[model samples]
Target: MLSGRFRLLRREEPERANAAIGLDIEVFDAWTGQARAAGTLSGGEGFCAALALALGLSETVQAHAGARRIDTLLIDEGFGSLDEEALEMAMEVLAGLEAGNRLVGVISHVAELKARIPARLEVTPGLRGSTARFVIA
Candidate 1:
């Protein structure tokens, strides 16, 4: 769930903001004005942007429906594409959204991200099939 309006404005181009839906998000190439090739975002930029858009849409929906509040967001396994700086920025954005009962869960295998977000629920193979356990730092 999201609170208020989530707007993603390019630092330079404020007029070209695009709307995004829950897991369905769009990634635009500012230079070519076209969508990137499918599964071609090498540097986490696509994932980060898509996440931002989803957040925006969720917020919009909540406000339009007059919901009082909502909490939690889940992101799974995509941090490998980002560089250190971009990763840091993404982490900051997620961390900064602590207000309004927002809880962001990033599911990632990257060691850096695992170390950064110390609390997590890990799932692993067990005697039968798999087991899940929460790890908190």
Candidate 2:
């Protein structure tokens, strides 16, 4: 996603050896120029990779087949791990999806996101219960 390459890994092991052996992805680190398993990625890197893959796959499926495009995407709380620049890039990607008439819902406690995203439903904890409020910019 971040100038990195995604290599799809097919099932390599025998079915009896590992039933869970399914498709996996190896992500190339832009800095190191080496591919590593997706499981080895940092939280922020993982989030970016996942977002990019989902968006790419959605576009590919809709363009190739007569399949319905994905209408919505919901991502929970992975923004905190990203740096300022990475966060900016991630927001730009999501914004592009929104521009395509797709509903992209992001749930995060990151303060920067509050400034970037306009309409939001925020939840604050209290003694009785969490207070929820709608904030629109």
Candidate 3:
């Protein structure tokens, strides 16, 4: 879903990347279509690429390994970095993964994201402490 440019390559040399932080990957600009280092991506773009990778790997596991079923995916805090279009795409991907009794949980402080989510647990921070509430919309 990432403009068809999401690629996870297994390169062992540090010369290929700045840091071998694990999960070697590269992505192309959505508009420019030019290949670029995944590390060089803007915060939002990097988040998108990482999410796509996670989902892709999950699908691979589900496909090749019949003994396991990935039924839960939880994402925390990257929503605010995404632009409207990217956010929409990310949300759509997350929603699609919810098929087959899977539970997708997103934890974000973005108001736009909160508004779009129907069923959510709202956590409020007050002077004294914090309070949490759940909505089953």
Q: Which residue pairs show collisions in model 2? A: none
Question: Which one wins by lDDT: 1 or 2?
Answer: 2
Which window of 10 residues has the lowest lDDT sum in candidate 1? Answer: 1-10
Per-model TM-score, in order, reads 0.66, 0.80, 0.82
Which lDDT tens digits does candidate 2 get at residues 7-119? 43443544466455446566656567776777898788888877777777778988888887779989988899997777888988889889989999999999989999999
Q: Model 3 — TM-score against the truth? A: 0.82
Residue ranges of candidate 1 with Cα displaced over 4 Å: 1-43
Relative to the true structure, how large is the alpha-carbon lDDT of every model?
A: 0.66, 0.79, 0.79
Model 3 lDDT tens row, 32-81? 75656677878887898789878878989989998598999999999889
Model number with the top TM-score: 3
RMSD (CA, Å), candidate 2 to true, equals: 2.8
Evaluate model 3: give its lDDT: 0.79
